[model samples]
Structure formats: C-alpha cells, structure tokens
Target: MSFLFFTAVGLLAATLGSLVGLGGGIIIVPALIYLGPYFIGKEVSVATAVGTSLAVLIFTAFSSTWSFHKQRKVDFRSGWLYFLTCGPGAMLGSFLTQFVDATTFQLAFGIFMLIMALLLIFKGYLKPVNVRWAIQRTYTDDHGAVHTYGYGALPALAIGLVVGIISGLFGVGGGSLFVPAMMLLFRYPPHVATATSMFVIFLSSIMGTVTHVALGEVDVWMVLGLAPSALVGGWIGARIASSLSSGKLLWVLRITFFLVAVRMIWEGLG
Candidate 1:
C-alpha cells in the first residue's frame, strides 16, 4: 500500500514536473517529507527524502527529455553548458547539507518557493531588457518554426551555478529557476526553455544523486517504488506540454508554484 501510494505521488509529481521542466523534485521532496511517515509507517528524514527524490528524478528527467528531444525542442548546446557549469556548485551544496538542520532547510525551501511563485505571477508584467553581451542562436521546432534568441553565456553560467547549488541543497531539479531564467534572461521561447531545462536537470540531478548516495542519504526502496510511475508520468507530461500554448503552460506553472509555496510555508511554520 505504501508503495502504491508513493507510486501515485510520483506519477503526479512527474507529470507536473516534466510539463514545466522542473524534473518533479519540488513535488517529490515535499511529498516524501510530509507523507512518508504516514504512508510508509516510519519517519523519513529530510535528507533521505530529498536524496530519494533526486534518485527518482533521474528516470523522470530522462523520460521527459526523450519526449522533448523527439520534437526537436531541446537545445543541447545550451543544456550541456549549463550542466557543466552547475556541477561544481552542486557538489558543494551536497556537502553543505550536513550543516543544515531539517527545520532550517524547510524554512529556506519555503522562502525560495515563495519567491519563485511571485516571479511566475508577475512575469507577464515584467518588462524585457536587451542584453548586449548575449550569444545568439537559432533553433527550428518540430513544426519547422524557426526561433532566434540571444543570451549572455556568463549570466547563464552564473545562474546555473546558483540553480545547481539549490538543487543539491533542496533536492529539487532546479527547473523552477532554470526555465524562467532561460525564458526571461536568455529570451528563449517557452517550449525551448522547458526542453533545454529538462536536459540540464537530468545531468545535474545525476551529479546530485551521486553525492547523496555517497553521503548515504538516499532511500533505495523508495526510489524503486517511485521510478516506474515517474517515467510514465514524465512521458505523458511532455506529450501534453507539446500541445499546450506558451500562455497556458505558464499559467499552469504559476498555479503550481503558488500551491507549492503555500504548502511549503505551512510545513515550515509547523
């Protein structure tokens, strides 16, 4: 029964995560932390929960990325660059987790989620600024629609470093930051940003998971229970995302972030 419940949660998390290129860690980590005791008949530590989520995310991200790749939505060059730059930070964050208590970490995660929610809500009202140092690139979507965009490589690397650290620390895939950064800062199209973010997430997650495993933080049984559902959910989510308009996708992302923010705050306060 616990396995079934976790599998269901994984399905839901993976669906939303893949749809938004978040790699499902936001949902997975919180769910494991809050619900694991009740469902699994034992208390699960925050670190263990986070590590398990990251392990499961490996499958979810891969599944989603594959779906996006099929549609020619992934920007491999940018994704690889972000992945490479993010590695060091992720390693550092994983080590730093030892110094953080569960309550403090939860509070910080809540604060971070709140900020992301606000950003998503106000994204449309924000004005765009031209970045003079941006590297230009062109991409053709599955439908042969060409998109030309520019972004500063330095800025992206800096953002990736931050995102990686947060991901390792919080057990999130960092898609919450990455997708928005690419769309708003790099001027990427929404779909392209999401797809590219997923690829980057996959690579970064692998690094984080390895660090967690070395720390003995991961729950292998939980990961096994969650992975299958996550894979299927990820594939389904990517398919749905391919059909959604950018506006609709952003709306979904905003609403989800708001809900997560509220939950995180409640948990943190408790």
Candidate 2:
C-alpha cells in the first residue's frame, strides 16, 4: 500500500511538473508529510520528506529534461551558467532545512504554496521586464519562429542562487518561480523557459540530494518506490507539453495548490 501510494504521488506530481517545469516537489513534499503516515505507519518529518522528495526529483527531472532535449527546447548554455550558483545554493539550503521544526516547516510551506498559487493567478498578466543589459540569445521554435531572449549574467546568477536555495529548503525544484522569472524578467519563451528550468533543476537537485544524504535525512525506501513512476510520468508529461498549451492544466494546478495550502496551514495551526 505504501509503495502504491508513493508511486501514485510521484506519477501525478511528475506529470504536472514536467508539463509546467515545476519539478513536482510541491506535491511530493506535502504528500509525504500528510499522507505518508497513513501508508507507511510512521510520521515523516519535514527534513526527511524534503530530502526524499529531492531524491525522487532526480529521476523526474532527468527524464523530463531528456525529453525536452530531444525536442530541442533546452538551453544548455543558460542552464550551465545558472547552475554555477544554484548548485552551491542548493547545498546551503539543504543543510539549513535540518534546523526547521515540523510545525514551522508546515506553516512556511503552506504560506509558500499560497503565494505560488497567487503568482500563477497573476502570471499571465505580468509583462516582461526586458533589461537592456541582457546577453541576447535566440531559439527557433517548432513553427520556425525565432524567439529572442536573454538575461544579465549578474541577475541570472542571483536568481539561480535564490531559486536553488528555495529548492533545497522546500524540495520543490524551484520551477514555479523559475518559469515566471524566465518569462517575466528574462523574456524567455514559455517552452524554452520550462525546458531550461528542468535542466537547472536536475543539476541543483543533485547537490541537494548529496546534502540530504550526508545528513541522513532521506528515506531510501520511499525514493525507490517513487522514482520509477516519476520517470515514466515525467516522460509522458514532457511529450504532452511539447504539443499542447497548458491553460486548463494550470487552472487545475492552481486549485490543487489552494486546497493543499489551506490544509497544510490548518494542520500547522492545529
């Protein structure tokens, strides 16, 4: 039963994550905390849940990234540059996660989820910042339309550091923030942003996973249960995303985030 539950959580989270560049950490972390005890017969602490989620993320991000790569959407140059700071930041954040208590973690995560939900609500209305300092880059989409976009090195590094820290601390892969930042601040096309975000996540999660493993914060059994399913779902999701717009999908995710946020907050208060 525990295996099945974990697998389901991984599959669902990875599918949605690949579609939107979210990396499925939001769903995995919360599910591990709220539902894990029911199936595993033991409560999973915030640190353990986060660590486990990050471990599971490796498979999801990898499969999704590879799929996106095959579709010629990933911007590897940008990904490597951002990872320079993001990787170290993830290590720092993962180490820091140990200091947070369950209550604080739940409350903080709930608030974070609510904020992410709100961001999604306003994401479509946001305009690109378009900094002149950007190192201009270009990508030709499947339709033969060339999209020009870029970001300043300093700004990109700064965003990577912050996003990486958030990813390690929350086990969320930072895609919610990454996609928006890319689209709004860097003027990246949605598909490119999402693909590149997954690439960066794949790298950062490696650093995060190492930190968590050193701290003995991960549940190896849980990761084994979740990873295979997550891999399959990630591939499926990326394939779907390559050919589809995600308008309705985003709506469903927003609702899910709202419900999960409220429940997490309520639990923390209790």
Candidate 3:
C-alpha cells in the first residue's frame, strides 16, 4: 500500500511538472505529510518524507529537462547564471532550518506556496513580459562572439535569493516563483522562462538534496521506488505539451493552478 501510494504521487507530480516546468512539490510534500504516517507509522519521519521528495525531484527534473532540451527551448546561458547563486544559497538555507520548529517550517512553506499560486493566477492574465528597469549586458559565448542583451539584474538577483532559500527549506523546484519572476519581473518569454527555470531548479535541487542527505533526512528506498514512475509520466507530459498551443496551455495551467492552490490551502488549514 505504501509502495502504491508513493508511486502514484511520483507519477502525478512528474506528469504535471513536465508540462508546466514545476515538480509539483507543493502537492508532493503535503500529501506525504498527511498520508505517510497513516500507513508507515513511525517508519517515515517528516524529514525522510521531505528528503525523499527532493530525491524523486532529481528524476522528475531530469526527464522534463530532456524534453525541453529536445524542443530547443532551454536557455543554458541564463540557467548557469541562476545556478551560480542558487547552489550556495541552498547550502546556507539547509543549515538555517535547524533553528526553527517543524510546524513553523511547514506552515511557512504552505503560506509561501499560497502566495506563489496567487501570483501565478494573476500574472497569467498579464502581458508577455515586464521590463521596467532593464539593464544591458554584453558577453562572449563559447564560440568567442560577443552578444549584447538587456535584462533586469537586480530583480533577478532578489528573486533568486528568495527562491533558493525556499527551495532549500522545502524540497520544491521553486518554479512557482521562478517562472513568474522571469516572465513578469525580468521580461522573459513564457516558454523560455519555463525552460530556463527547470534548468536552474535542477542545480538547486541537487544542492538542497545533498544538504538534506547530510543531515540524515533522506530515504533512499523511497526515491528509488519513485524514479521509474516519474520518468514515464514526464515523458508522457512532454508529448502532450508539444501538441498544445501556448495560449491554450497558459489558460489550462491557470485553471490548474487555481484548483491546486485551493486544495493546498484547504489541506494546510484543515
């Protein structure tokens, strides 16, 4: 029964995550917390549940990233830049959790998820991108040619900081925040932003999981059990996403975010 539940969670999260570029951690973490103890009793601790979820995320992100890469939507340049800050920030955030209680941490995580969901709901109806204080930067790529581009670095930095911290503390991909920040605040195309966000999260999750493992919080068996299901689900989702138009997909995702957000809030409060 526990095996079935874990597998179901992995498949569901991976499918939605691959299409939207989010690992569905908002759903995964809460489900584990509420349902795990019911079946496993003392065997599955809260730390173990969170850690295992992060580990499963590695497979989920990898599968989705492959799909995005095949479509040529992934922006490696932006991904590497974001990773530079998120990696170290995750390591730092992992240590900070020691000072807080478990209930407080979960409550904080739930609230943050709610805020991100609301932002997504509203941002979906806005323009393609917003760049109020854009800055121009020029850099040389691997081919030794210099290219110039404009973006808002200050807001990007701030977004990275907060997302990195939340990701480390909670096992989320931070897409709920990253996608919006890139599209609405930094003025990136929606597809480009989503793809880049996935690439960035792959790095953050690795660092965050490492810290969780070091603290003896990870459940190796649980992660191992979920990987296969998540991979398959991700592949299926990618195929579906490839067939849909951007406008339709955005509307579909908006409705999804609203439904999931309401459920999460209700679950957290109940």
Candidate 4:
C-alpha cells in the first residue's frame, strides 16, 4: 500500500515538475518528509528525502530532456555552458545539508516556495534583469517558427551556480528559478526555455545525487517506488507542455506553492 501510494505521489510530482522543467524533487522531497508518516507510516529525514528525490529526478530529467530533444527544442550548447559552474555548486550545496534539521528545512523551503509563488504572481509586472552581455542562440519550433534568445555567459553561469546550490540544498531541480530567468531575462521562448532547463537539470541532479550517495543518504526503496512513475510522468509532461501554453498550469502551481509554503512555515513555527 505504501509503495502504491508513493507511486501515485511520484506520478503527480514528475508530471508537474517535468511540465515546467522543475525535475520533480520540489514535490517529492516535501511529500516524503511531511506526508510520509501519515500515508506510509514512515518518517524520513531531510537528507534522505533530498537524496531520494535527486535520484528519482535523474529519470525524470532524462525522460523530459529526451522528449524535448525529439522536438528539437533543447539547446544543448547552452545547457552545457550552464552546467560548467552548476556542477561544482551542486557539490558545495550537498555538503551544507548536514547542518540543516527538519524544522529548519521546512522553514527555508517554505520561504523559497513563497518567493516562487510571488514570482509567478508578479512575473508580468517584473522587468528583465538588465545586462550588457549576450551569447546569441536560435531555435526553430515544430511549426517552423524561428526564435532567437541568449543570456550573458557570465550572468548565466552565476545564475546556474546559484541554481545548482539550490538544487543540491533543496533537491528542487532549480527550474523554479531557471525558467523564469530564461523567459524574462534571456528572452527565450517558453518551450525552448523549458526544454533547455530540463537538459541542465539532468546534469545538475547527477552531481547532487553523487554527493548524496557518498553521504549514504539515499533510500533505495523510495527510489524504486518513484522511478517508474517518474519515467512515465516526465514524458507525458513534456508532451503536454509542447502542445499548450503553461499559463493555466502556472497559475495552479502558484496557488499550490503558496499553500505548501504556508503549511511548511506554520508547521516549522510550531
């Protein structure tokens, strides 16, 4: 019963995560820590939850990146560029997790999610981060529409560094920060940004997972329960994302994020 329930959680997490290049750990980590005791009669530490989530994200990112690759939406060159700095940052952040306890993790995650929700709410009102640097890139969608986008190399690397640290620290896959920055600051088309984000996440998750494994934090049983659904959900999410505007979904996510954020903060305060 627990395995089945976990499978369902994985499906939901991966579907939502992949659809937006989120890599599913945002959902998985919290669910395992907060809901696990109630539903599965087991409680996991933050480190175990994060480690397990990152392991499962490996499959989700691969599946989404493959789907996006087939659509020709992924920008491999840029993904690699971002990963250059992101890799080491992942290692750095993973080491810092040992200092965090469950309540602290809950409080911090809640604050982060609150910020994410606010970003979604005010994204339209926000201006692009002004920068003088540019590295030109182009993509052609399935319908033959050409789109050009680029981010300053230094700025992107810096952002990727922050994102990698966040990914390892929270096991969130970093799309919460990546996608909006790409679309807003870099002027990437929605599909292109999401596809490319997944590619970067795949690399980042691997780095984080390795660190977690070295720490003996991973839960093999949780990974086994979540991985199959992750594979299915990632592909499905990419397909859906490729076909439609994510406006509605983002709105839903904003509410969900806000609710989760409040839950975490309140519980942490208690």
Which parts of model 4 have CA positions greater than 4 angstroms off? 127-132
- Which portions of model 3 show Cα errors greater than 4 Å? 41-43, 128-150, 245-270
TM-score of each: 0.93, 0.98, 0.82, 0.96
Record all residue pairs in model 1 with backbone atoms less than 3 Å apart, i.e. clashing. Answer: none
**Candidate 2, 106-211: lDDT as tens digits:** 8889999999999999999999984765488999999899989988898899999999999999998999999999999989999999999999999999999999
Best by lDDT: 2
Clashes of 3: 0
TM-score, prediction 4: 0.96
Per-model CA lDDT versus the true structure: 0.84, 0.93, 0.70, 0.88
For model 4, what is the C-alpha lDDT against the true structure? 0.88
Q: Of 1 and 4, which scores higher on TM-score?
A: 4
lDDT per residue for candidate 3 within 46-85, as digits (tens), equals 5666677777777887877888788766778767777877
lDDT tens readout by residue for model 4, 110-171: 99999989988998787766554458877877788887777888888998999999999998
Candidate 1, residues 75-188, lDDT tens digits: the string is 898888898778667766776777788878888888887787788788777755666445788887767788778777788889889999998888888888898888777778
The TM-score, computed over Cα atoms with residue i paired to residue i, of candidate 2 is 0.98
CA error at residue 182 for candidate 3, angstroms:
0.7
> Model 2: runs farther than 4 Å from truth?
none
Give the lDDT of residue 122 in candidate 3. 79
lDDT at 198, model 1: 89
